[model samples]
Target: MTATLHTAPVTIPDTTDQRVVRRRLGPGHRIRFSFWFGPALALAIWSIGSATGLIKPAILSAPWDVVVAFQDQWVNHDLLGNIVASLQRSLVGLTLGVVTGAVLAVISGLSRFGESLIDGPIQIKRSVPTLAIIPLFIAWFGIGEEMKVITIALISLVPIYIHTHNGLRGIDGKYAELAETIGINHGEFIRHVVLPGALPGFLLGMRFAVTSSLLGLVVVEHYNAVAGIGYMITLAEQYGQTDVIVVGLVIYGIFGYCADSAVRFTGRRVLAWRQTLEG
Candidate 1:
């Protein structure tokens, strides 16, 4: 009789992400045209409601009326000029805020002395909303471009500081230990590890900061702004032009969407190595 050979059973490790499992499963494959589905549905509903006389222009303008309002602004108002003015203010404020916030984050994150000096004041400021500070800013700088830009900068910086500082501090200690073992210089180790480690937080903060910039712009423009989307909204409110108001709101929505999309796209490119859920 031949001896029978026994084989050991092999165990395969679970590679599935349980967090994803807990959520409702989507199509196993990505939907190429699905991005437009939600917006298209919403527009369809709005148009149907308007046509059926269920939704009135008093509550919400018809899509056609909004288009007409946009054309009116393009033809009559200095719409492009207002947009340019708004962009200049927002971009300038964003540049200043991002640069300052990153520098402060680096300083505070790397040093106990800096953290002790800087962190407390910033934390105090975090409790206050940008809207709450407009009066004080007006008192200090008057209702001018100076006040508006400064307000937007202040609004934008806090998130950047908080997130980037957290990111820098949250870097893996093992990497630092390894760097030390390799006898890498402090600057070189930082260049390779610290900045990269903090990039996710930085990108995340940038998304928020951009939104905050727009928010601050809205508040300031509503107050006494001579130009901007918010100014258009204010004018429309005074005139009871629901369609124009919708146009202003739509412009704002578009700005926010486009800005977020740009940041997300850039972040995906920059952090290509990251295996994120969205990625």
Candidate 2:
């Protein structure tokens, strides 16, 4: 018998036909374009109107004039200094608000008695307008940086506290029972399960808190602050410098967007596993 050489058929995977998954644009990406595009289109229209003398240059400064004013402030380093001051106040307020709110949330979540003690006052405070409390804050802390930071923190606290409390309370009883069945201790359960379960709500609250804090910064700095964007806007208004005021407003908007983006980015990074599991 003649031995015939047998060759095994080789199977090739269709790499060429493999589908590529395109990542959908996230809210942040959409927002990035929306924020810049809307304002840019508006500025273009305004520029056209100003050039045609349809709008008064004095009342609505031309885009070029605004650009010139921005450059002037940049060259003088006044804008940078104001930005730093505003950022400092916002960061300080955010730190205080997040820590206090999270601590209160944990306490209130774990104990009905603690919730009863603090929930009523927090609810009452929430009903009151944050801007309305600025005078009291100033009176209590004096017209200083502390007053501004405190006001921002106070404004930021309510949303975070509410969301965190709700998140913790929303934890399913089944999860706890399952943990118990698995012989998980309270500490391990909280660290591995409770925190992960509550993360989405907490992160949502953080986003809200950060944005609120930035907005509150404007109101807080409006009073007796000599170095913030709000103070710069006030001064600009006094001199009928509409361009400068507009610039300050735009800067604040940018800052708010940046802060919101940061919270969202952090949430995505920290909760990546949770998101994957959910999906």
Candidate 3:
């Protein structure tokens, strides 16, 4: 008789939920290219659509027509000057909004009394659309650069304040206790503990603020302006220049994309210690 050895049966654990599904395309799949991928694909599609006569130039101009419009705007219409004007407004408004928001957020987040005073009006303002306030702004500040800049500043500040304030409040109470136990002064505690804790939120808010700056600039420029791409877009609309309108749209998109990218780049540098999927 042959001796038989009994072996224990091994069971495989379920990994369906745990497994990461990698795709040929996804957010995780970084397309490392110098050329803008989405715009290139869109341009190709637009060219094809226009060539096929599926898209009307009256509605959406052909890619080539847009290129020609861009050249014309650059050569004859002072595109660079318009861009500079828009950028100046965006930068100034963004600076004021960001600084004010940070200061207010710190004050409100630190003290209950400060929060009581600052938070209510800000929350109320947040509920009311900034665009809706334009008429009131015009009535008060009039149709000038002041109104435009203020409009941009007002639109940009709320988001940063909300985000930064949340960040500050979200800091673990244990850290405060730890700092107190270590006998750290209030100023030192704030600089070392509070600022770092709230930085990610501030940066996050900055991204939105940057976008809002552009949006506010566009709104004011469109409403009442003699310069800027928004003004150019307004003129294009009045003249029914579809190609020129497309050019303006492309410029706005580029400006927004570039600004957002700059913020993200800065965020990555500042928040290098943070472990996130974004990295």
Q: Pick the candidate with the highest TM-score.
A: 1
After superposition, which runs of candidate 2 have C-alpha atoms over 4 Å from their true positions?
Answer: 1-59, 274-279
Clashing pairs in 2: none
lDDT of 3 by residue, 139-178 (tens): 9999989999999999899989999999999999999899
Taken over the whole model, the C-alpha lDDT of each candidate is 0.88, 0.83, 0.89
- Which candidate gets the maximum lDDT versus the true structure? 3
Which 10-residue window in model 1 sums to the lowest lDDT? 21-30
Query: Against the correct fold, how does model 3 do in TM-score?
Result: 0.86
Query: Which is superior by TM-score, 1 or 2?
Result: 1
Per-prediction tally of clashes:
0, 0, 0
On the 0 to 100 scale, the lDDT of residue 206 in model 2 is 91
User: Where does model 3 exceed 4 Å of error?
Assistant: 1-35
Better of 1 and 3 by lDDT: 3
How many clashing residue pairs, candidate 1?
A: 0
Write the residue-wise lDDT of candidate 1 on 49-133 in tens digits.
9999999878999999999999999999988887888888888898889899999999999999999999999899999887898
